[model samples]
Target: MKGRETLSNRFEDGVLALLPRLRRFAIGLSRDRSDGDDLCQMTIERALSRRESYEPGTRLDSWMYRIMRNLWIDEQRARQRRSQTFASEEAGVSIGAVGGQEAAVEINDVDRALTSLPDDQREAVLLVMVEGYSYREAAEIVGCPVGTLNSRLVRGRDALLAKLGEVA
Candidate 1:
């Protein structure tokens, strides 16, 4: 049907428009660019395949994020069952030249600080601080109460500041 085709085209466009944000979230979760790319691709594929289930006029970004988070959790469980560890620091080395050493170092330090947080805290920080999600939206994404999300954010923010020596 022409109507269905049009809707599909629109959905695809929406998904495409969200690719960069999704990729960034994936990379933040996986902590390796290669794995993050794979996760991002998987999320896009799954969203496209399941487009029929998506409700029109709802938050498409939220739907995509739920899919990504579910997939990441599944992969993590599988890896745990297989006794696979995360890649080493060397494995996370950036491929391209640094744009600026000072900025790069600061970014790396923040990333390192984030990685040091617990999984829940990291997710909280990523969704709120990094992705700019509202407390209610992020709480919904992570399937937690807004109060819990706020608590996690507070703890995560404090830990990051401590790790970065930003608290004098």
Candidate 2:
């Protein structure tokens, strides 16, 4: 079937095009690079395994994102159950290079502020700001009403501002 072949080729291309963005999203969701890579791999595997479920006319990126989000949530839950720990060691081996001191300090400060946020607020901010999802799309991805997402976003911003303090 030439049509089937064409459709499969298009789908494969679509998936490949989405990989880098998906990895970035996975990194935002995970605590470390290793976990991020694992999440991304799991997402790709799941998406490919369930390719038949994808509607031909629907948004493939959104569908794959939903799968990734669900997987990340599951991993978060498992980590919570295994140990309610927040230590850096619990985050698994670092998979990327650590930056210079100045960069590391900035990153640490941001990480501290981010980790201090409540989970819902963090997810809202990260999804909308870091991952560049629209409000409507982020609300859908997070399975929250738009108003709730707005509230979380506001709170998250305020909290970060407070933690970071005023800058010239």
Candidate 3:
């Protein structure tokens, strides 16, 4: 009982400490403040609820990030499915009219470019560029050899440059 209590306290402290970074990550994934807040809340709730699944001495932040990433992917899939039914209707809506239109357009362009990338390249860009992970850390997170990660980074950068051209 004492051991469990101590572990719980530590986990709570860790989660509290990581909240700001987690929120930032969620915001990057969601692109909406409300959605990001919800995602962060969901992540914290899930982490606390499943505390037993966490291995002590492991990288809690990485584990939490994986969970958050999976959740975001699932949410994106759900949104895709929902949008499919209204795709034609939504298609006519100009991206230009969105709130923060210019910024949204830029984000959309980046997202489209990102989606066009091969999976490994996209993942590498997201991990290193968006999330600020070091190359070695990203390689570990993506479960790839360092050389492979370097190759992906080079290819992805070239692809982005080609897509963005002089506009970026």
**Of the candidates shown, which would achieve the greatest TM-score relative to the real structure?**
3
Candidate lDDT values, in order: 0.89, 0.85, 0.86
- Candidate 1 deviant stretches above 4 angstroms: 84-168
What tens digits encode model 1's per-residue C-alpha lDDT throughout 12-126?
9999999999999999999999999999999999998889999999999999999999989877865763443344567658643467797788888998999999999999999
| Candidate rank order under lDDT | 1, 3, 2
Candidate 2 residue 79 C-alpha distance from true site, Å: 1.4
**lDDT for residue 130 in candidate 3, whole number 0-100:** 70
Please give the range of 10 consecutive residues that has the lowest summed lDDT in model 3. Answer: 81-90
Q: What TM-score do all the candidates reach, one by one?
A: 0.50, 0.49, 0.51
Off by over 4 Å in 3: 86-168
Best by lDDT: 1
User: On residues 1-168, what C-alpha lDDT tens digit does candidate 3 reach at each position?
Assistant: 999899999999999999999999999999999999999998998898989999999999998999899879867865765565344756768744666877887888888888999999999988877766668768978999988998998899899979977457
lDDT of 2 at 50: 86
RMSD (Å) per prediction: 14.5, 13.9, 12.5
